[model samples]
Each structure stands twice: as structure tokens, then as C-alpha cells.
Target: MEKLEERFERLERLAEYFIEEMADFKKWVVRFLSEYKREVDRQIREYKEETNKRIEEYRRENNKRWGELANKLGTIVEDIIYPAFRPVIRKYFGCEPEKTFMRLEYINREKGIYEEFDAVAVCQDKAFLLEAKSTPREKHIEEFKEKAKRFLQYFSEFGDKKLILIMASLSFKEDFVKQLSKTNIYAMAYREWEYMDILNFEEVKGA
Candidate 1:
């Protein structure tokens, strides 16, 4: 009976030791998980901050590029294409060639509206209502018609004794070109420079 009692005492001590060991292990696991969660949160915060910074930088750069491009386009319209059109204005309208006008506003059917146009070339007695299309399509007819009607309404104020609808399109459909021509509109496509008058060029260039 004494030997059996000693064995039971030994078994109880063993179970107590096992319980203490399990408690220590659970504490260690909890500590490790807390550290892991803290690290994950810190990393996520850093990544979001970095991503936002990059986005802001990209927006600034993109805005700058867009501004430069818009300025360049304005320069091309004012310095290059508008000047090249001087001859046509001089020949048809008998006006001095050194003229400049911007197509800023127009009236259609006597109704005023906010508008922007490609350009307006003017000499003393003639005005050219010019619109530039990167690649003109037949779909442009409605807009073109509106432009023409506007010119007809305001030609007298502009001293537009002669009216020319000058358009510069990168390209055009054959049917569109034919239809525009049939409408008695003087039109020129990219490949059709011969359609432009040389006498007008001579007068504009002082040749």
C-alpha cells in the first residue's frame, strides 16, 4: 500500500510539471503572434505612404507634360499654319498680307455661343474661316455647315467681301472630298497642295 501511494504521488508531480510547461508554451506563442501582427501593420502603413507619394509625383509630372504639349500646339497654330495661309487671303480678297486673327468666337443663326476654332486668317477685305482636323471625316459635315452659316452671318462685320472655307485635314475619304467640292466649298486635303492658289502665295510672300 505504501509503494502504491508513492507511485500516485509521482504521477501527480508529473502531471503538474506538464501543466506548467504547456502554460509557458502558450505564453511564448502569444508573444510571437503579437510581434508578427505589429510588423505586418507597420509594413502595410509604409507601403501605402510610399504608393501615395509616387502617385502625387506622377500627377505633377503628367500635368507638366500636358501643359508643355498644349503650349507647343498653340505655337504651331500661330507661327506656322496661320502664316502659311496668308497668300490665299491676299489673292482672293485684295488685302494686305500681314494680317492675323484668332477664331475665338462666332455666331450661328444670330445666336452667340462660346467657341474655339482652329484659326481665322484676315486681310482687309477677305476672311478665311479656317478649321483644322487631324483627320477629317464625313462626320465633320454638320460642324462645318454650322461654321459656314456662322461666317455668312458675320462676314460683313469682318469685311469679309470674299469668303473662303479653308480646312486642313490630315486625310479624308474620297466620297467626303467629292461631296465637299460639290457643295462649292474650296477644300484641300493633305496630299492635294495643288488645289491651293500660287498667285495668292506670291502676294502673301511679297514675291
Candidate 2:
């Protein structure tokens, strides 16, 4: 009932319609994929930014805690260690200090001299100069020796008395105590980790 050439023409029209529909479908799929990729990239960028902000805040908090701890340790020399000086001096030196001074500063503008002493104790015939450190090291020992050399220049009244230098800390290594014994300076620290006493008093007295 249908002619062969007419049937062929009808099939060609259907083929053309399918081709146009396929092209539109492909364009829509590409657009959807591109939009999805952009959304994913934006989410990833926001996540990274939030993570970095949290990390920076945590770091700042950690630093604040460490700073507070350091301040507490610094005050130990002034508050805890210096207060124990009187008893230690009386026990070791066999006499109580007549005059006690803490955090004393002496400056002679005319002579261009400036000095600061952590603690000083004066007796009838002896003057004790105390230097306290939270953590004592070899450099601190050397620095205290230098300070002792200039003590009489600042306090001329103490020049007539026998000057005794004391280096004090919360604790000292056994080897460091031995090293201190060889020096003229007396090392004061906790004995048996309980009470404060001079570690090298006898050795220093004999020297």
C-alpha cells in the first residue's frame, strides 16, 4: 500500500529528529556536570579556610599557656628562694644577719657605675651576697663570679667586711655541686630534695 521511495523518506525524517534530540541531551548533560564540579570545588575551599582558622586559634591558646608558666617560674627567685636566705645564712655562717636587703640597686652617676643585687645579708665581720636562679647553669656561675667582683665597688660599706658570695637554686646537679665545691662561692640548694641548705659550705670555708 506504501511506495518504496516514500517509505525511505519517512525513515530519513525520523533519523534526523532523533539526531537533533540527542545533540540537545548531550548539551544538557555537559552543563549539569560543570555546575556540579563548581559546587564541589567551592565546598572544598570553604572547608580548608575553616580548618586553617581553627589551627591558628589553637596555636595562640597554646602559646598563652606557656607564657603563663614561664612567668610563674620567674617569680620563684623573688618569692620562694629569697625568703629562705636568712635561715640558710644563719645556719651556715654561725650568726644572724644584722641588716638584710633584697632587690637592692646602686647607681653612682658621677663614677658611671650601676649594679643590682638580688639579696644581701650583713653580719658583724661578714657580708653575704646571694644570687638566685630558677635553673642554674655554668654561665650563671660565671656571671655570679663577675658580679661578686664588683660588689664592693657598689657597696663601699661592705668593703671592710669579708665578702661571701652565695649561688642558690631550687636544685643542682651532683656534678654541678662538685664543681661549685672547687670555687670560692657557696652553692645553696635543696638537700635530699626536701630542705634548703648550702651544698658546698665546708669546701668553700676551707678554700
Best by TM-score: 2
lDDT of 1 by residue, 1-207 (tens): 579989999999999999999999999999999999999999999999999999999999999998997777656546555655666556555777445676556546565454666677666556677776655677676678687676666555765446566665535666766656655454443445444442222223232
Off by over 4 Å in 1: 83-128, 133-146, 149-163, 169-207
Off by over 4 Å in 2: 1-58
Give one digit per residue, the lDDT tens place, for model 2 in 1-207: 999999999999999999999999999899999999999999999999999999999899989988987898777767777788999888888989999998889888998977888899999999999888877888888888889878887678889999998888888898888777777888888888888889888788898
- How does model 2 score by TM-score? 0.70
Q: How does each model score on lDDT? A: 0.64, 0.87
Q: Which residue pairs clash within candidate 2? A: none
**Backbone clashes counted, model 2:** 0
Q: How many backbone collisions does model 1 have?
A: 0
Error of 1 at 25 (Å): 1.1
Ten contiguous residues minimizing lDDT sum, candidate 2: 73-82
